[model samples]
Target: MPPGVPLSPPPPSALANPESLTRRSHRFQPKSIWPVAILAMFVMLAIVGIKAYRSLSQNPAQSEQTVEQEARLPVRVTRAETGLAQKWVFDDGIVWPVKRRVLTFQAEGDIQAIAKINGRDLRAGDVVTKGQVLATIDSRRQRSAIDTANADVEVAVQQRNQAQATVVQAQASLDRAKSDLELAKTELVRYQELFDQGVISESDRDVYLNQVDQAEAALRSAEQDVRSAEDGVRSAEAQITAAQARVTETNVDLEDTQLVAPIDGVVAYINIREGEYWDAQRLNSGSDQDLIESAPIILVNPQDIEVEIEIQADEANEIDPGQLTYVVLEEDVSAAQAAGASNQDLLEIAQDNGSRGTVFSVSPTQTPGSRGTQVSIRGFSSAQNLR
Candidate 1:
């Protein structure tokens, strides 16, 4: 009567009755070639045959009934799954420039003048390029020194010229004296010849010889004067060289007066105002006190920024380079915490609005006078991100 109940095949004697088979077909003529009873019997036969084969193939210890009972047993179910892991670190930090420098003077002087660019006086917050002068030191003294040196060099050059002229005059005098000496010798020889022929007195011969001696003495004096003149020329030349060296030094000092920007950046500070002296000696005290006394006169930096974070040592250990980070303002974080936001909620909020960064570096040791380790986070500024 049930849809899936099993039935058996008919005996061979029932199949042998051809007239009975025809009667069965006619009994369900509206259904099909076979009567409903015979069709039911065929379906039942297929089911029974499959069960018989299953029973034969099954192990003796594992019956069909036992397998069915085990499958029917109830199981206590629960939901369980795995998902991606993430860790969030919450902290506060101060913002900083990604790259920056503090400008200081090497040579000390009074801040006499500051550079002007395109008719504008350079000051803090002004953008500058490499080699662009920032400010000028007092160079009035240097200029004066240079002038004095130039005058000294000119005087030396004049003296050298005068000594050279003196040498020339001495040489001319020496030449005249040589000619006189030759004439005197010739006269003396003539006198000696006349004396031999009794044509002149011995006193006349003595006069010519005395004249020759005077001419020779004058020649020696002229030669000595020439050497002295040459020495004067050389001394003057040496003085000129010394004066020229002084001029070079003054020029270098003048160049140092102009404080040029070493790199392209904004002028973040100017410690010395006009007329303020930057003492080179203050830096030599070998103490921290001098650091402020001789600190940089200017500070400069790029637009990219960073933040320094102080986090618990345990949490800091988990952090590594390239790990994702977010920097929310300290005030904002405090406010969020005061409002009772959950850590998860706070993280979600920061992720949405805070600047994205990464763990750029982590301090190997804890910060001085601080228990927590310091971490450096670098990120693009909000303004840059908008672009």
Candidate 2:
């Protein structure tokens, strides 16, 4: 064939199949096939988008719920040796110190400075021993008072010495007057004897008698002076005693300036500070009219602490003294703090920190207006920080 001539149509064997014809026609019309492909793609994308939207909206809530479940505390379980369920009753109670001391000013005065322990100033939450000096008041005036009392005592001693000397002098003077009186009496008796025997005149005898009376009067005056002197000595002694008493009292007041801890305890509170006046009137004695949280200072014994349990009156009767009791705390703790996480397969998370104790005391009678009986248990975990 010439190079310019067109080729003739191919034979029918190759194009005999309708499928092959269809394929060729389809290739020629690519735009028509594109629209169908795009529509199918749109349908598939719509399905996928609906599923994805639903998944995004619902997955967060489910994840949040799963996290909450993980953080939730597990319940505590108590078992009996018999593997049988035991009925246990719960109650509300308070844990407190066994014996707490309400520290107060034994003597009223202005606060000076809190006593330092190992150079650390004493304050609330400080541990103290018995008879430890906790604080000091303004004792300058008290020292002055003690000095004045001492001076008073010295003056009294001097006065007493003077009184004793006066008594001795008075006694000496009385002795001399007595000697003169005896002499006068002897002379008067001799004169009377002479008058009776006619040895002397009557006038002479009468003069001698008058001399005896004068001597007796002088003796009486001396005796009275001695009595007065003795009385003065007694008065001086009394003054000395009174002065000594004052001195003792002043010394006591001076000691009062130092606040001492009466027992071994931790200082729970301090309602006063240095240089501040502690008003004793705020202290609560035996009276229903007023109640105080604490005294100017307070002490709590950390070694001894107890929990008071309250339960229904009927239930209290069911529990005997020395019977074991388990107290469940109202609060919860994290799983990390739990005692044994393995045995707690029944429940997960917050296991009970229940304290083990025994019933030691039963109330003699129900408290007035109380809904239950009060019982005391001695052994439990002591919580020092009440606040």
Candidate 3:
């Protein structure tokens, strides 16, 4: 405590204890502490951190609830019940004519005339009666053959008449021979009776017996000639019959020279031209000389049109002959939209509008690439009118 003497430094043990050293040491130590301000700042920071954590934990649940409410908004829906003969799935298919026929020549010949050609518009669905002529071949050779057959028949008929005359002559000769034989037998008996009664000489009786033998021999010869002549007549008659049969067959072939349509149809193709040679059996040699090849001279389709569709065996059982059906044409977006005021309402407005079609047939076999069934749709209106 002397002012002039420097305050003796505090003891090491007392300096080590900060509270005691700060109070006792002569060097000034600040009494106002800053630890309370630092503690207060730490407390404020902890409170703010707790509040922020609580807000962050609740934000995600509130956002998810808002999203769920938006997702529950209502949408429009429609339902319809339609009668269908058969439900069918679409498949890739080819269009084909309903009926087809080919006209061919009966005999090999050159085409003399062609009444029609390809691409010509023919009357649709006209019925062709039996024996109608559709096309013609060269008739010169066919007529010549027919004439030859006719000449042969005429010759055969003349020969048959001559044979008939021979048969009549043979029959007459047989009758005469039989009468002569009987007369000879009666003469022989009379001569024997006369010789036994001694009314005739021995030489005369022997001569009469010889004469009877000669007459009998003559009658046998005549009968044999008659039999030969009858046989010849029969042979000639058979030849005549065969010749007549040949004439009839030739006539039939001649009639077949002209090709005719077999059924009612529309002409589709005409392959022959006038003066064209048609040989069905001839083959091409690949040489420079061109030979006419014969195929179907004309092609036709029948009046009745039919569509064929392939379907699964299981689905075909539901189809009937007279059930009602509907067909939807190719999608027309413009037409669909025009029927309604808005795009969202188009389907409902078009339910009773647009072109109508129908189902025509169903096939028994499964179509290629189809898992279920296939059906054929046909337009009720004419093909030209259908879109």
Candidate 4:
């Protein structure tokens, strides 16, 4: 055993079995498979044994019933009740006032005042009563016109009185002319009788003839004067009639200056402000296509809020007065639809978020210029917020 001696060769037995020389690697052995298979068989046998024991412990009929009960599914049931058939219909529509009016002035002037509510100037959505003054224009011009017309009427009356007096004077003159003519005729007869009796000269009878001619001329002149006076009276009467017409016109203009609410309603719109100039011409002759929308004031009776829905003629026929209706807002409908809500859900949403209404009217005929029929539904209660 020296340190420099050569290493010796491996043993033939170790070389023949290299696996035995290193640590042995674990591998599936045929011997282990039988134990796993036996364990699984024992587990199956235990489950079957348990089932057989439980089955034998109960009566045969009771066991069958238990199995059947366990195999069957559960269900719910309710007692029968009587009820009427019901159906639901959904539609979109706009809520409008049953009575709507657009008010404008016939006379143009500067707006002097606007109606107030709760100490604030009148505006859209304000409530008003019938004949309430919604606004007023400067009425001085119309008032002046009325005064002028009245003055003209008074002047015409004066002229008429003066003419009547002239007529009376003319009548007096006519009467006097008649009396003079009679007197002249009587004198001529007397002169003729005297001349025939040779108690009057021919020259004197000729002088009586000249006096009768002069009296006739005076009567003709008086008749002409009476006719002239009567004409003056007729002219004065015509003037009076014309002046009265003017007065009536001015009164109408004055009324036009004040915008009055024609119905009990809410103010839907106000196109004018205090101190703004009002022009009637725009109402009648403006280029705007809708005169009503352009009016100075717009009113709507929201207490009679009616939802106007256009539907197929067939659908309209199914609707009747007093039928229940629900009006859901467009936003609610959209949201509910986006959430994939069912019809019942939509109805519930409408009940919670929208107004309840009743079918007020259903048009028998199609709407004018449209193929759809109009169905009107009014709120069950007065809805001031509908409009």
| RMSD each, Å | 15.1, 29.1, 29.7, 29.9
- Cα lDDT for residue 321, candidate 1: 82
TM-score each candidate: 0.49, 0.59, 0.54, 0.62
Model 2 poorest 10 in a row by lDDT:
343-352
Clashes of each: 0, 1, 0, 0
lDDT winner among the candidates? 4
Report residue 263 deviation for candidate 3 (angstroms).
4.4
Residues 338-379, candidate 2: write the lDDT tens digits.
544342431222123455567779886886666778888766
Which residue pairs does candidate 3 place in steric collision? Answer: none
lDDT ranking from best to worst?
A: 4, 1, 2, 3
Alpha carbon lDDT of each predicted model = 0.75, 0.73, 0.60, 0.82
- Where model 4 places Cα greater than 4 Å from the true spot, the runs are 1-92, 116-119, 125-129, 138-141, 280-293, 317-370, 378-387
Candidate ordering by TM-score (highest first): 4, 2, 3, 1
Q: CA shift at 57, candidate 3, in angstroms?
A: 59
**Candidate 3 per-residue C-alpha lDDT over 79-143 given as tens digits, one digit per residue, 9 for 90 to 100:** 87664233333333323345556567767777665444354422333445445676677777667
Between prediction 2 and prediction 3, which has the larger TM-score? 2
Judge candidate 3 at residue 331 and give its lDDT.
48
* Model 3 superposed RMSD (Cα): 29.7
Instruction: Give candidate 1 misplaced runs (Cα > 4 Å).
Output: 1-109, 116-125, 262-269, 281-387
